[model samples]
Target chain A: MTLPKTRWRRRSAARPDEILDAALTAFIEAGFDAARMDDIAARAGISKAGVYLYFGSKEALLRALIDREIAPIATLLAGFAETGGADPEGTLHLMATVAIERLSDPRFFAVPRLIIAISGRFPDIADYYRTEIVERAIAALSSLIAKGVAQGVFRPVDPVLAVRAVVGPVLFAALWRHVLRGDTDVPPARVIEGQIDLLLNGLKP
Target chain B: MTLPKTRWRRRSAARPDEILDAALTAFIEAGFDAARMDDIAARAGISKAGVYLYFGSKEALLRALIDREIAPIATLLAGFAETGGADPEGTLHLMATVAIERLSDPRFFAVPRLIIAISGRFPDIADYYRTEIVERAIAALSSLIAKGVAQGVFRPVDPVLAVRAVVGPVLFAALWRHVLRGDTDVPPARVIEGQIDLLLNGLKP
Candidate 1:
């Protein structure tokens, strides 16, 4: 028996990435509850049925987007201590650098905005972010700071608070860029550099 | 013509403040678009006409809210130097404490969230904030930092960037509490203290 194969199968198979990209825009522009699947499909040049075929539902699509696009950069925190950088200051600086680079991408920044905008209506997004991104980053950064304090390379500071100190500024820069455009947000890279410079000094013994 | 004898006139004369208070709660709960004038009136225990008599329109109400509620704290930065703190570190610490104390009020924090959430759809709110609040705060904070640097109390860093370094984290903390409340945002007071502690060292000459 010969299957009646068409170009649609191959096209639909490749549609997830494009659909996800469109979904990001849709989610940002319209927000979560107001975002329509058809709009996303239309933006991606795919059919409604194809979107459903690939993502199954909106929740699945969001989860897929987070896992595929966001979780990797966020998970960079997990391997941070295992990575290169001999000095703790250098290591923390590296983390700031990586965060700035990763979050500079509008796509990455959009996810958090979507999470912030939607988390009110959808409580799980908060938990998802807290567990998936914030907790991991805090854990990794805290470990690095703890090492620095132990090695006498850095002054003693609450590792958790110190990590929040670092993350808060970086996250703020990203949030400004994500939420409002124009002259509102200072360049994220500049903020990152400034934050790391302050940290390098502030964490000194 | 004889004026109609009614208690409504007396009530409506007292309407603006109560209406503004109710407006804050309504705006926070339902957001700007979804929030209804009737709900605000009901919440204020005033007639709908009383709200209109006082504020005129929603835009006018918002402007009054900013002028009455947010603009005052923003203007507080203007007199910061004239205030009773002796040293620059103490001055900056004072500023941080004042910021934390003032912003910890849910009413104040809610204004920023409403502005951030609705600014995309309503550009005026952003401009209103930029002028009436943000620019004021920045200008004041910049002056404070510049004075510290000149007096040899703080290192010479770009006051603008330094002001940002101060504000970004504070704003982030406030935003977390405003946008996604749970265990996510560190209490504003703790962030303020930690930030000031770091600033004390980082800005030391």
Candidate 2:
């Protein structure tokens, strides 16, 4: 009983993730509009029916892919926002480090790249992404910055704009590395450190 | 003689720009590979043969489009770097203001957004863009930063990383407003001011 139940649970839990991975590969290789359910199913080593059983449509698969990949990061940011009130500066440093590390990975960056590509054609997809992921992340970061301002550790700045400054560099680094395929002699960690330093200390002596 | 020469020059010079604008619209509507020369020619109110007479192929058209749109911005950055050594801080402020104002326009932002979309499949195009535009811009900005540091105006920092810090937020704002279609209640000018403030003045109270 124990062996059978353990095996069943593992297989059931992993199937959705496997399908999502296959969907992402298919979407990347073929644009979202052109990617076929059959290709995704073949990539997953499953039947098309099986793919449909898991995700009702291609759009659903994309939404799920975004959720699976981005939801954890959002959760982590929320956690920081909740508990890092005492040391907003330190927390921001940690957040930047973690974000750069994760966003540097091509796999993690792919969904956002895909979103950027198709957003012009599919406004709904863009809106969905903004509401589900970006707004949440920005809100969490803004709350943390607000906390810092409240505690008098940081200068009085609009948290909304501050969130953009904090996030813009990290997003740019990811775009530079992945989308542009630029050569990176400087390690991402160092890039993150440099950005955070400039962000916190500025260039003025 | 003067009328004929002036008319001829205007028709010839403006034809290329008109064709390039049509090409951009066609490319945006259809992904680069799928876009048709006929569509571009038709959009430009010319025959396909006319388009071929001017630009040989879709790839050539893309290259020309990039050059027509982006070369001026690169030139502007170089100009600033050359004459802006005396007042680096003021120049940076002016640069950011100009960059944000230009980049905020959807038409101006279109090329970079298009590049990001297709760069995965077209590494050569990406390379061409980086060498022709991004590298040149970064070099110019780095020289300005180095000049500032030499003048004892700015803190000692690696100019390359510093360039990233300076360019990243402006790029991000463009992406957010255009690619993501995020609603912007605050004017782009204010956003640029806030980012510049954060960069020049540390968050330390």
Judging by lDDT against the true structure, name the best candidate.
2
Model 1: docking quality category: acceptable
Would you give me the overall lDDT of model 2? 0.82
Count of clashes, each model: 0, 0
Q: Estimate each model's TM-score.
A: 0.82, 0.89
Model 2, range A29-86, lDDT digits (tens) per residue? Answer: 7667667899988888777988888889888898898888987898898888888889
Candidate 1 lDDT over residue span A34-142, tens digit each: 6789999999887888789888889777878878887887677668765733577777878888887787777777677666655554567767776887667777888
Q: Which portions of model 1 miss their true places by more than 4 Å? A: A1-12, A33-38, A46-64, A178-190, A202-205, B1-10, B33-38, B45-64, B82-86, B182-191, B202-205
Model 2: residue B157 alpha-carbon error in angstroms: 1.7
Chain A only: TM-score per candidate: 0.85, 0.88
- Please give the lDDT score for candidate 1: 0.71
Fnat per candidate, as a fraction, reads 0.19, 0.65
Clashes by residue pair, model 2: none
